[model samples]
Target: MSRRLRLLFTALALAALLWLLFAAAERALALAQRFLALPEWLQWTLGSVLLVFAAAGLSVLWWLLRPRRRRRPLPVPDRSSLEQRIGQLRERGADTGALAAELGELDRRRVSARVYVALFGEISTGKSSLIRALAPHAQVASDARGGTTREVGHYDGAFPDGRTLVLADVPGSREAGGEAHETLACEEALRAHAVIYLCAGDLNRSQADELRWLADFGKPLLLVLNKADQWTAVERDKLLARLTQQSRGIASAVLAISAGGSERYQRQLADGSTESVERQRKPAIEPLLQALDRLTAPGAEGLENRRENAVLAGLHQRTGTLEARTRAEEAERIVRKYARRAIVGALAAVAPGSDLVIQGVLATGLTRALAELYGVKVSDVQIEDFVQQAKLTLRTGSSIVLAVAGNALKAFPGLGTLGGGVLHAFAYALIFDSMGRALAASLAERQSLDQDDASARLKELLADAGGTRLRQLAALTIDAVRDRVD
Candidate 1:
């Protein structure tokens, strides 16, 4: 058919369809007019009955469309129940800031029965956006860059059941110089009634590992695939499938959403001026919020055990940190004790061999002292063997390096044997410090390394003590020398 004929035929079909619809309405009105001619009382009764059925149908639809989160009512908790838990924390030596907060939050829950849900993930993972989207009135501290959230952010919200909630925004963790902050987030996650692990898009190996670690705590977790607005339908589906496969046994649920995003818009003013505006789109977080409500509701499974394990886990982490730090400090003290005496002996050396002999004796003594610092006992024969091996390693690997370095300093006027003595003292302390640290490590591991492995590790330690560390130690020893001379 020709193009003009085809369009004319289509227009005529549309006009015929409209005329038929008007004719049907005219017939319906005529039937209504006939009913109006009946008795007024019968007409009124029929109209009221139809209105009642319409209201019933509308009510059913509204109930079906409401949010589906159904939670059992919470009971009144005993006043003393939370207090008893606080006392237990004290008795168990839960003495870190994170543990302290857990106790405090638990106590609050007991008094008011509020469910705490925390969001945790790596930096720039849309955690804050998720929170704001879930609660538009939410007061959250968020930034676009990493490391802005130095502390946990607390925001209040309510669920569909009118139950209160405390939504916590956990800062990103697991980066260099971010251990302390990450530890705090872990503690927060433990005490929360439920956890939401937020992700910007895909999960790499490190992020996946961290997610597994968090899931191991046994809290209810919902893995959120955020920023859905930024992805195409096909791309989003592919990523969603990958994440859901990755979360197989860990996360209870996975959801995708766009909390908020910027859209460019133009507005005209009353004075005829036009302005550009960057408006934020309303968040699509209703589904995620409903899921959280279901997880934290009263009578949830394993809720009590989850809270207890979290507290105990935080306590264990804190205790381990304290023990490791104590060991390091004690190792430092042992190194300084022997290194000071080695310095005095180095100053007293009148011949080259004399200084070497004094340092070998000091090495043996240092070996026993460091073992004691590590809560180990070394026999005389073992100390002798360690001294011999250490002396051999030092003579073979480091003798030329130190002599060349010391001889270079001899060119300084007015510094005769004293200059050489300073270099020797610095070298002795540096070597002793390295050995003490290595021994502490081996003792901590409760294992022994072969001679070759030990020697290679010693070489690594010495290489790490670069020229800057050498100069710092030398300056410190010079002050000690002056004090001894006085």
Candidate 2:
């Protein structure tokens, strides 16, 4: 039988015995009262019977009020067991084929000999328009409001070299409340090996914040100053000059373009429209392509290094997700651990026989505290349930004593006022303060269980982990893509 069941049965049996004793005492008291008027001798005999019944009742009460023997503390779970549990959780997560498939797809795209261009900027920067212009089949939502794209969108097409370039369009950034979102987007861009930081012709403060945020990612940024047709020649030149000067010290390349104008330029080509209009509207994106070609040179060590960096970045993201899941699992474990500890500790605190009053008070207080903390109501039945479930025995019957005292505090005004106030305070402190601290600490430790800052940590865990080699490859790949675009 379960420990809880045995404890429950014992409690029920003791309760029945107490009830029988009380019933007998009541019967004797009734008989003695009936004989009072019959005769003096009979009355005296009846009174003696009443005294015996009263003594028995008092003895039963004393037994019920006695403290229980203290129980031994339960042993804490070992580190190895905890680690094993964590490993099991990780294995379960790994077994999900979908995650692996996603990673594999990413890996395949990375190696495909294509210019992987990513369009990124603040909201409504015409990033989608640029993608649509380059590849008409690429379908992306173009919304004027910021942050239209929540997830990264991938577009794949062949470059002039028969190498496929996979273009990614990420979510638009906002001036405020977008750092976390933009950081994630920028990281995705870094993985792609090339970036197109698109901005509308009218660059406002929010647009500026988006560009500034991307600067932190440290990828070779190609600034596509879009919607150039919206500004005059002098205004456009001034804007381009300002941006180019701003990016002078930073290793970012800048170009002004109008996706709207590109569409018009395409129509002009089809219809053999006016050459002067085409020349006037065309944006300077061609020059941007030339710059990318120069940056990602063939046989250069830099291109190889970037490929490795992209792979490692992908691995780091996956590991971060794994770590988050581990922390959540560890939190649940801590809750279970402390729940057992609190119950066992409360049982031990009530074990001494001579200190029945103190033991009863402590047990009552602890149980009440636990119930409050766990958001459960306290009752003798519930206490019995927990004790029985835990498979613990009460030697001195302190559990019964504590239950009676708790009940008494509810009934009698004086005891109720004093005990209820003190026990409530004590219970709150014990459960929330002490147990909460222990649980939080356990969760914190689990969250911090990341691989140390070793250079090989990525290399060992990732499919393509050599950091220096990856950087060089990515740089080269970027150059190769730029050459074709130009």
Candidate 3:
């Protein structure tokens, strides 16, 4: 019997003994009262002895019948497996295409080649006009009103040597909202190969924010004081000096530009007469380009190679990690479900004999044995497990009876109560032994199922990861593995 059932039977036996003692004491007291001959001291002594015996019996029963305290299951650590899975995922992601795309973008831009340009300052700083001047094809939506360009506009252009330049325009930098747009524009400029900061001949709070944002990009930048036509030469020069000094630590170059008269200004002869009015003067942009050329020259080759490898590595790692985690979770779920089903089957096998008191003992023993053997601690076993356990128990019980028939008949002399009791106990022992064996087999089956489920989940996970990695590689590289192969 299981420990719990054994304790329960002990309790019932003690209770029956207690009842018998109480009845005998009451009868002795009645007999003493009727006789009136026995000494009061003798009768009292007899009652006290009986009471003491009852108490001792009760105490012994309590010790024997007290419930067994079950210990908590130990936590199983599977860290080695987990770490191995992580390492595999990292290796896979290293060869995927997402990493390649990221690297490719970085390579094209070149790490040190960057520019920051912000279109800002005053109600009509001609920020849009400045962008148009730099890249004629860059379309910035504009009108006569101040708020015509509420959003930031960004454009990129390539020079003859494949070096790229980015430009950004913010419509008006004076208003609070306009200042925010200018800041965004400045940020975009900062991320470029170099920076071109646009401003009217004057400075404002919004213009200051734009400049501050530009400083954050930390790249080479040029400051363009636009609309220089609005100020006289001396006044413009004085303001330009002050602005230049304010931006001394930041700007690589600072120049004055007349957005309206830029074409004519470039063609001025010594007599102050325009010779070639059609040619545009790009005073600020030329210096900005020169700075970018110097920065990108040193690490061009190394940067290209690293960018390509990093992109592939990143994609491969992500795909593998996702697949591994998914498979692990799936394996855990499948194993849990399989265990539950096995337990349910066990419970169903023993349900028919549930009405018999001894059946409860058998059920309890069989359940405990199954739990121990299978490493399952469920509250109840499945009906199927119970049915299988019962069949084995019955078969073993019959075999034992047959084997001991001659000895049993010889001891009893004939079929009687004593013989029947002996046979029942022997059969119970045999049945318990059979149940133990059946539980062991069931547990083995469960473990096999768990292993199989884990293997299947792992395969599915790897397949998915491989497929995703293949697709991404195909998208980003010239020599990727084919989809069919993946």
Candidate 4:
């Protein structure tokens, strides 16, 4: 386009803008005049109504557009209670060594009286590079490949104010088949007095979740975008703004830096031949340095309580997971034991019936055992009531149970040749297995026996005749009958 055409377009846009402004001004003037001409009382009433509506509109807009804050206070269990739970797990033969070690380390760190800050992020986010920038004298390794930092390495670092700290360079998260390494990084993060979460670009879903997880621990946190030298000034400003908005209340601050990672280039020698050269990019990390100085002003001593709580909170979650797994394994064992016993009892029956008749003694024992295993208190009356409820559920589903057993007998030809009473024995196994599983599941979820819930689950289990389950029950029946004859 010629200069005249560009000039004409610019003028048209300016004129349109000016016309809009003038129109708005004229409308405001007319409204003001009309308001002045109204009766004083009417003017005051209309003015009040307009003010209220304007205020309401602003409030709605603010609510919709405000930056979200997602920081949640960490819930740390009582120290004594947590210790006792770990001890109980140890006695129950669950591995509790790691949980106990976390407590010991928490105390050990408190005694050291030194601040610790962990560099945390996904693989290739320049954590190792940042470590080299902050602790220049340290021998930190950097690689283009992900998962280069496999273990936690510590180095002495200093703030601009001359205060010293221990900076932990941990393995980056989200590497292929690197769950253990990721776990190690997370544990070290919780152990530190504060954390610097590094990223080279925008936050993905997993990174966002990781930040929120750290925020839940209530530790001092800074989210840093590394390798800022790669972005133009305008692009960097826009990226930082988005990150700042993304991290709002979760991070104490969000800043950008170039961690001075190595770059490779070709250089011409005096002989006019080109050669490959590698050199570290000059780091731009003043913003990060200032953020660290402000965040760590409290020192380790002042930050001990939060650090301890964070460690203990992490341990609590780990211990609870272990405890649940151990209990589920134990519950399965108990269920299988009772099922085998029921199969043997049915084989010994003088008159094996078409319907399942749950052995009352075994049913009561199963109920009490599972209840005790789950730490639920139950009186004899409650135990009796649960047993009766199981009997009622079995009665309702007895035909379905026997039909499933008969099909199993057909599926497992060897069981059919075992004898006539094998059908009854297999039916008994199905009844007891279903009952035990249903009760255990109810107890696990409800933490207390809900008769209706257990019964409903029991009904479902009785009608379930999966091929694998039938095969297992058939094997159990054959073993029990053969053992009885022997």
> Would you list the C-alpha lDDT of every candidate in the order shown?
0.71, 0.52, 0.50, 0.89
lDDT, candidate 1, at 221:
85
Q: Using lDDT as the measure, which candidate wins?
A: 4
lDDT of 2 by residue, 324-419 (tens): 565445544444444333333333344455233433443444434444433344477654443332222233333442443344334434434543
How many steric clashes between backbone atoms does each model show? 0, 30, 44, 0
| Candidate whose TM-score is highest | 4
Give the per-residue lDDT of model 4 (tens digit) for 223-317: 99998888999999999899987788889899889999788899999999999999979998999999998898888988888999999899889
- Over the stretch 199-255, how does candidate 3's per-residue lDDT look in tens digits? 766666656655654454344456777777668989988988988766766666677
The parts of candidate 4 lying over 4 Å away from their true place are: 1-59, 67-70, 141-144, 265-276, 351-358, 379-386, 409-413
Tell me the lDDT of model 3 at 10. 99
- Lowest summed-lDDT stretch of 10 residues in model 4? 349-358
- The Cα error of candidate 3 at residue 472, in Å, is 51
Model 4, position 224: C-alpha lDDT score: 97
Candidate 1, poorest ten consecutive residues by summed lDDT: 70-79
TM-scores, all candidates, are: 0.66, 0.47, 0.32, 0.85
Pairs with backbone N, CA or C atoms under 3 Å apart (clashes), candidate 4 = none
Write the candidate numbers in order of decreasing TM-score.
4, 1, 2, 3
Query: Residue 296 deviation, candidate 4, in Å?
Result: 1.1
In candidate 3, position 289 carries an lDDT of 47
